[model samples]
Target: MKTEAVRLYGKKDLRLEEFELPPIKEDEILAKVICDSICMSSYKAATQGTDHKRIPDDVAENPIIIGHEFAGELVEVGAKWAGEFKVGDKFSIQPALNYADGPVGILSAPGYSYQYIGGDATYVIIPKEVMELGCLLPYKGEGFYPASLSEPLSCVIGAMHANYHTTPGSYVHKMEIVDGGKMAILAGVGPMGLAAINYALNREDRKPSLLVVTDIDQGRLDRAASLYSVDFAKSKGIDLRYVNTGAMDNVAADLKAITDGYGYDDVFVFAPVVPIIEQADEILAFDGCLNFFAGPGDSNFKAPLNFYKVHYEFTHLVGTSGGNMDDMKEALEMMSKGLDPAGLVTHIGGLDAVIDTTLRLPEIPGGKKLIYNHIRMPLTPISEFEEKGKTNPLFTELHEICQLHNGLWNLEAENLILEKWNKLT
Candidate 1:
């Protein structure tokens, strides 16, 4: 079968081309992609091309499709999965595949790199390795966009789930946040940061008694505060504060004042900036855990850490690139119960504009950029829906749907979007 996709040949070289896909093997499955969200990592792969750790060495010679966050419907299920997964079954993928048992096994390779097809294409074949690793998950969500978003949400969940311990003479490591402990999200208010905020507030396992979200951008900080209000946190019996550090004369001192000069129990750094990272380290409580959640494209990106704090106060740092299948499952379960991370989505477009969108993702201001593969529409910001509705009736309907859900994207909005522009077979 022939399909169109965005293929990466070399650094800063992305080609939108049509190619023929081989027949699915007996153990493989063929899926038709419905929604693919452009991620910052996709932009990194596009700019780095073959030099990227995830891109296979021979990608320049054999160009590969680039995308990982996507959702689709099964078009052809192999004999092995015929009964278990039939045609028309909707699904999402945990793209971090670990086929080999060794340390260096397929950690860099995901759904959208060399040897494996990605969701940028109209259809992709599910490799035997992916099925064997159980990375392909059956999605029962109302829409494909939400299923596609689960991958990013899982990364946020993984960061929160990461455990750390203190070495107080004994080798035993303590797990979870200290009960009713204080937490802070440094340089938060971005899409993933907002997800972390939601997970920190809503997770039943380790709920923070006090949560503070800090950002330099007042606009972003205000949006986060409006979405997750201090009043709402008070109702939940938790103290929540949104602060713009840029406005403060002494940011670190102000943050410490919130915790009564004791510092935060857990701190999450959402930006790759070294200054921000250092600031996160500066505001740690004794035996505090810092999670470097952002994935930087530069391999040599270095940040200074206080070894003194690590040895004396037991302050430690950890980083996670992506989540496992279990994290994805947990995110799906939470979303099913109306956690509504869909508010993280701020922009939407169609496959026709995906190539350009992927190339310019980092520069684009806003949250998730959802792309409908079968649809042919321009990139539309959610904030412009009401204005666009004046000229286009379709956008007017979308505006109405969003209004019903408190001006946020919901299943109704997704269904309305697909109902207007789903031309797939």
Candidate 2:
């Protein structure tokens, strides 16, 4: 058997490569790669080559697959894993795993050494370890449920769970409110910012009195215009929802305006640019929080610190980088509940579309663009555990477990054995 994969050969160059299939181990299942989204990490890797910050320094750039944000189904399941997960189960990709099995295990040993597998392919062999880390998603139809959004959403989940301040026993911030409170979003209204926006809006026991979104791009401001649904943008005023200063004038004035001249209570610096954080320093209220949502590893990525402002004004600083398995699970839970991952997905493409779509990250500002339907059209759709049980036995198990525990697992069927026939003469 063979598989087609989008392999990057050098800086800025990508190609579709074919590889021989490997035998699936008892704890491993074969997955047909279906959906994936282009990301800034992949784009920067192409532009910066091995200089890419997201890919670890020790890893080889070329001859590697390209996608990280994706979702897929189990096509083949190994027998030892038969009771572990079922076929036809769908889930978002949770790419991080920590192998602690004495460091000599075959399952994640190669991945730990080779820097993990990428998703720009026609097929992927899912070791039991990787499957255990994925999030099982809730579905509503034969249509792809957009579970491919797990990776980006997981990043939001991490930020939400990070350093939350509170009464010592409360969630993140013990204050228990945001969105409807005075909130400042720097470089806001882009897809990434939108995720933060919605998450802040929908936070339980934490309602923001005001939601202040800022962007120099008129287009982004225009898009932020629509976040006032019942579940998002709970603030009573749409006039205060978005603001545009074109990255030139003082954004402090706009944020101050939303906060009734007092400054916002919470500020989210969604863009990685230095100047934006500077402005966040200006308009954040005393004891307010400023979160650095964007991350850049450029040599010149340093931002001038206003330590005086941070200390005197009592502003809180926080940031989150990548998605982990636990974060992915939280994201899937929100998606399962019918919450929009906040229009953060701006583009959707197939495995063949990686290079083209990746190149557009800086230009495209918001939304977590999707890739499932484009790459995995040949896949049989699955919505019910009972449905998957007819063909692959693992479906019922994975589905029941997901519904009951709000988690995801990989379902597959595989045979990894080398049986000796009659003695050779």
Which candidate should be chosen as best, given TM-score against the real structure? Answer: 1
Clashing pairs in 1: none
Please write out the lDDT profile of model 2 over residues 265-379, one tens digit for every residue.
6677878888888888778776667778787857678776677866566567787776666667666766666665525544434445555556666765445545442242222
lDDT digits (tens) for residues 159-265 of candidate 1: 87775666588777776566588889988899999888887778877688999999999999988887888998887778999988897887878898989999988
Candidates' C-alpha lDDT: 0.82, 0.57
Q: Give the Cα error of residue 184 in candidate 1, in Å.
A: 0.6
TM-score list, all predictions? 0.94, 0.74
Q: Name the best candidate (by lDDT).
A: 1
TM-score of 1: 0.94
